[model samples]
Target chain A: MDIPTYADVEAAHARIALHIHRTPILTSSFINDLTGAELFFKCENFQKAGAFKARGASNAVFGLDEKMAKVGVATHSSGNHALSLSYAAGKRGIPVTVVMPRTAPEPKKAAVRGYGGHIVECEPSTSSREAVFAEVVAETGAEFVHPYNDPRVIAGQGTCSKEMVEDLGELDAVVAPIGGGGMVSGCCLTLSTIAPKTKIYAAEPKNADDAYRSFKAGRIIADDAPQTVADGLKVPLKELTWHFVSKHVEDIFTATEEEIVAAMRLIWERMKIVMEPSSAVPLAAILKNKELFAGKRVGVIVTGGNVDLGKLPWAQS
Target chain B: MDIPTYADVEAAHARIALHIHRTPILTSSFINDLTGAELFFKCENFQKAGAFKARGASNAVFGLDEKMAKVGVATHSSGNHALSLSYAAGKRGIPVTVVMPRTAPEPKKAAVRGYGGHIVECEPSTSSREAVFAEVVAETGAEFVHPYNDPRVIAGQGTCSKEMVEDLGELDAVVAPIGGGGMVSGCCLTLSTIAPKTKIYAAEPKNADDAYRSFKAGRIIADDAPQTVADGLKVPLKELTWHFVSKHVEDIFTATEEEIVAAMRLIWERMKIVMEPSSAVPLAAILKNKELFAGKRVGVIVTGGNVDLGKLPWAQS
Candidate 1:
């Protein structure tokens, strides 16, 4: 697969203009005072499916040919990606099937159903999910929309940066959490093209630092049974995402679980926004490496807000 | 005091421009779809001190005469108002004394100290609080900064609507939660002057429906030992606020405790904002009276976001 160009990002922005939310850019004096960085947060938590996954899902659904569109779309996600694909497909009057782990949050499951997606519950394991999704594709003949491992998805996610840059002007650096690396890869690709002088960084939770390890080793790395509050960052990296990130990203930093919790609390208390632990990774990275970001104009992508209020990691017993 | 005219709001906007946050207007397709109203959420939760009280506090502090400035300012509040006064006074290098109930949240007391305000804890009863504040002012010679009852504070709070009207042209109606009535009274005054056709409505919790009762009876009504998740809306209606609200407000509506909790959840889940129960009053009203707001352009002032995550009302035990 070819690397997505800046033109592809521009085209994606135009195509998904009406479909996705032009999420707000939030700046905080409290955050700036704490980190000494002029930070601009792209609030993708306010995106259509409560995450940046909507951008990718919308693009993939709209990119399909008439025959492929008739086949509809399928994906395996126990979190935001499932709901995003379901929402995007449903909006386009297309059928969607989502394979999710049975252990997924009840609210997330309800959201997928609310968006009219057919849910296939699989065992709570990566291998089980992939196997069930394969069977689903075979039975339904649906076009598979890879969550973060496809060029179309990456290009689509890049539109977020394109809009942010348009709205907030050039930034000295851009930071986003690296899960399967779709958002960071897209951010890197877009920033490298539009603002080449800007540094691009990927933040990952220490419990699920496969992307960080991979970036350093110049090869794919996987973490099995990762343990972190940022549940969405547990997925292993794919070659397509790894390749794009390696080419465009400048560095990958890891944030400890405690730091992630602190950042989540700060966003809740100071910014007054409900950010999932995955979304807090970027802020965690900034807070952890304050010296690196101090006095710099930085852009951070808040990737999603799909947290269960009841299960918030910070609530003291 | 004269009712705050559009000119007064414009003047307050200028005076407090450097002191408060120009909070962003938040829009969400998910929330719009759920409510069937084209809604614009003015995120005062992102304002300084985690609420719009900052605007009033800052205005009151800075609006004082040089002689009065040297005397400093004092107020009685459970949380947000104390923090706002502390923050505003700290900026002006003026000493501030906060009279807070002994039963106030620990986090709120910490915030007052964190912002460098001197605290004087009193009994939780309203009479006790008033007596304690009066003693503090008499002993320290600090000018009283009544939360939501003073003209300067009302003028400052009016700036919120001024900014909203400038950004989102010609709103059909503006909704605010009424506690002491500072926010709604200010909003009503400004909307009446600039956008006279725009209706101003106050949302009150059913458990503490003093404002609704007062609006109907054409006299001030007080809630004794008010019980609701909306701690900020428990304060009784003041004479000045009651007068302005009676003349300018189109109506006052009440929402149940369950509806407030549901609205708070919807804001967290759909809009990705951590709104306190008081802030959710407008949302609860909108959700409960959909036919009244259907297809109308409505603006809801999300008053504050200061709920303790550990003790959130909706958190599962």
Candidate 2:
């Protein structure tokens, strides 16, 4: 299997430049004061569909050949990727279908429908989601776009870090949340090529620390059950993503659920940006390991801002 | 009294350009579809201390002469303005004393202390705040900076629209929340001069629609036992603000408490930004009166994003 390189990421950036938003780099003195680290936040929360998934989805949809494109595309995601794929396909006037778990947030489901994607509801379990998605692909003959396991998808997600590095100059390290490891894997590849000395790290919720364990054990590790406020990080890493992460990623760190909630509230209160728990993972890691990052220049990719306002964790607290 | 003309606002823009953030202009296709208006959101939520109050505070702090600067500044505010003044004054190596209502959010009081401001808490009444602030000014000889009723502060707030107009270019109309009318008054002066044809409207909360009623009465009016989710709009309009607003403002619109909550939720969900209820007032008006802005280039000032996360009004629903 061919892997995505920095060149592929650069090409993907060129392809998606016009379609995606060049999200701004945000910095907060309050955050810097607390961590004693100069942090640059690559705000993909402002990206289309309010997440970085839009980059990969747009790249995948636009990369299809005329023959493949005629059949449209399908994906199984209960998160940002599903909405992003639906949005990209709708923009191109292509028929799209989304297989989502029944337990997904109503806002995410509404967003998919709002973007004109056909919805297939499956039982709120990984086995059910995969089984239902297989049926969706077979019935419609639609191209299956893997959320984070595909090289093209990883290459597209790399564009976020490329834009960050270009805008903010060289950084000592780049950190992003890890779920299926697509964003971090792509970030590692891009950073390794352009800023070879820069360390790349993945932040995962402690409740869903499969990636952290896998990184330490030098093998894939799966979590039977995950409970994290960062719903986006519940999935275990895939084979293709694991390959990139094992090769290029320097470390994977885990943040407790409390840390995640605190980070999310800090961003909301101090930075005045709506960041979901997943996006807060990078900041949470930095805060939890402040000693390591003190006085260092760090770049953190805030992945998404698709949060349920009424059910905010802080609100419950 | 020398009223701030368009020329004064233009000069103020140059004076405080270095100190204040040139906040970004945000556009959303989803928001456009919801409101049926091409909207440009002037994101003052990203400004220092998470509000446009930073613009006025920076201007006031920097505009002070060396002799008066030695004494520093003092203000009475229950929210963003207090924090903004503290931040601005602290940056200038000047002492600041903030007289806040005892009922102000604990987080806001903490923010004032975090920014190195001396806080004096009084009862949650205007008379109590005034009395406490007067005592503080008398004891410290600090310059009293009224949040909105001051000319210098109004000119400073005007810079927000100045930057917006420069970035967006020739908007058909401008909508901003009216709370003591500082921001709207300044906006009216600036827009009436630069984009003379651009209509200016003030969005007021239905519970605290003093400006709306005052405009209708052709005189300043006060609300009795005003109630609104927009905590910032509780203050009654003063003489200077009323004068500018009455002369230049084209119309005033009111948003219900329900509409304000819904608009706040929409901004959080769709725009992925943390907007306080006061900030959502303009959006609430646009969402309510879609026909008035159909096909027109509309500019809305998102005043601030300092909502207390723990006490979010929509949490119950």
Candidate 3:
């Protein structure tokens, strides 16, 4: 697969600009005082479909030709990507299908359906998901849009950092939680070319430390359903994402489960913003490594805000 | 007591401009669709000290003359007002004392001390609070800043609606949760003169519906020790706040406990913003009275975001 370039990201931004929300960047003096770092939160929690995945999903959905769009787009994600793609497809008046494990959270399934996506239930395994997804694509003759691996998706995700850099000039560092490395890769694709001076860091949960392990081993280290409060970071990095991660990422940091939950609660309490545990990983990394970030202007990408409120990490479930 | 005018609100805004945050105005398309009204949320939950009380507290602390300022300020409350006063006083580098019930939440007391405010514990009753506050004032010779009754504080809070009206030109209605009527009075003070055509609605929890009763009775029907999930709305309307409520407020709406909690959860899940139960009352009222607000542009004040996460209404305690 070809690696997405800055030009491709810029093109994606233009194509998806009208479809996706230009989310605001927020700051909290209380948090700044706590960490001694000037943190700028790119609040993609407020983004369309309540996540940054909306950008990539919208780009792919809208970029299709009328004939292709009529048949529509399909993906296999039970997370934000599924709902985001469905939302984008709905906006474009196209039929979209999401293949999800039968054991996926009911709320997540409901969200996909709410966005007008048809759901195809699969067995709870990687092989099963792939096998079921292939059948869906073949049956429907729909265009397959990979959540993060596709060049078009990476190009779309790149628009987040583009807007961040444009809004907040000359940040010392940019940080994001590394799930499949889509957002970080997008940041790398943009910053490495436009603002190369700004260091890029990816944060991961210690429980699901595949990206961190992968970074140190100088290769992709897949984890088999690693359990963590940050469900978003359980997935491993793909080739396209690894291409940007290995080349442009400064470091990948890990935060313990306790740290991730604490940081998540802190943002909710202080910044008055709702975010998923995955989004809190970057702040956790910053908190864990205070000396490295202190007195620096840092851009922290709040990846998404799609959580089961009833099953909040802190709430006794 | 002199009635606060738009001029007073404008002067208060100017005085507290540097000290308080001009919080953002946010809109949720999902919420707009749910209620069938164009809603503009004045996010005071994002205000300094995590509540709109910060505006009132800052105005009181900063408006003091040099001699009065040397002595500092004091208030008696166990809610957002106490912490906000402390925060405002800390900003001005002035000593402030809070007389709070010994049974007040530990987090609330901690926040007061965190902002460098001295705390004097009192019995959890209005009479006890007044007695302790008087003693504190006598001992320290500090200016007693009332929670809602004071003209300066009302004027300070009026700035919230002033900014809301300014941001969203010509709102059809302005809604706020009535907790001692401070925020609602502030809205009335500003809207009555500047945007008199805009109807003002006050929302209250049916469990603690003193403001609703008072508005209907044409006299203060104060409720003592009212219980509600919205802990912030337990306080009754004082004379000064009642003055604005009686004159300018079009109607006071009450939401059942279930409706308030549901509205609170909806905002958190859909809007991805952290707001306390008190803040959700206005949205609840709008949902209940769809006919009054349907197809109209309404400005809703999100009162505060200082709820105890451990004891969240949805969470099992």
Q: Best candidate per DockQ, number?
A: 3
Better candidate number, 1 or 3, judged by DockQ: 3
Give me the runs in candidate 1 sitting further than 4 Å from their true place.
Answer: B1-3
lDDT of 1 by residue, B1-317 (tens): 55566677788888889999998888777778878999999999888888999998998898888899988999998788999999999999899999998877777888889999999999876788998988998899999888988888898999999889999988988889999999988888788888888999899999999899988998998866687889898898787788789999988999999999988888888788987889999989998888888899999999888888778887764
Clashing pairs in 1: none
Error of 1 at B201 (Å): 1.7
Task: List each model's interface RMSD.
Answer: 1.0, 0.9, 0.7
Task: Give per-residue CA lDDT, model 3, range A131-232, as digits (tens).
Answer: 999999889999999989898888999999999989888689999999888899999999989998999999999998988998999999887667888877
TM-score of each: 0.96, 0.97, 0.98
True contacts kept of 3: 0.97
User: Residue by residue across A1-317, what tens digits does model 2's lDDT show?
Assistant: 77888888988988888789999998988789999999999999999988999999999988889888889999988679999999889888899999988888888888899899989999866678889999999999999999998888999998988888899777998889999898998888788888887889899999999999999999999875477899999888889999988998988899999999988898888888888899999999998889889999999999998888878887656
Cα deviation at B235, candidate 3, in Å, is: 1.0
| Stretch of 10 with least lDDT, candidate 1 chain A | A308-317
The lDDT ranking, best first, is 3, 1, 2
lDDT of 3: 0.90
Interface root-mean-square deviation of model 3 in angstroms is 0.7
Residue A297 lDDT (model 1)? 94
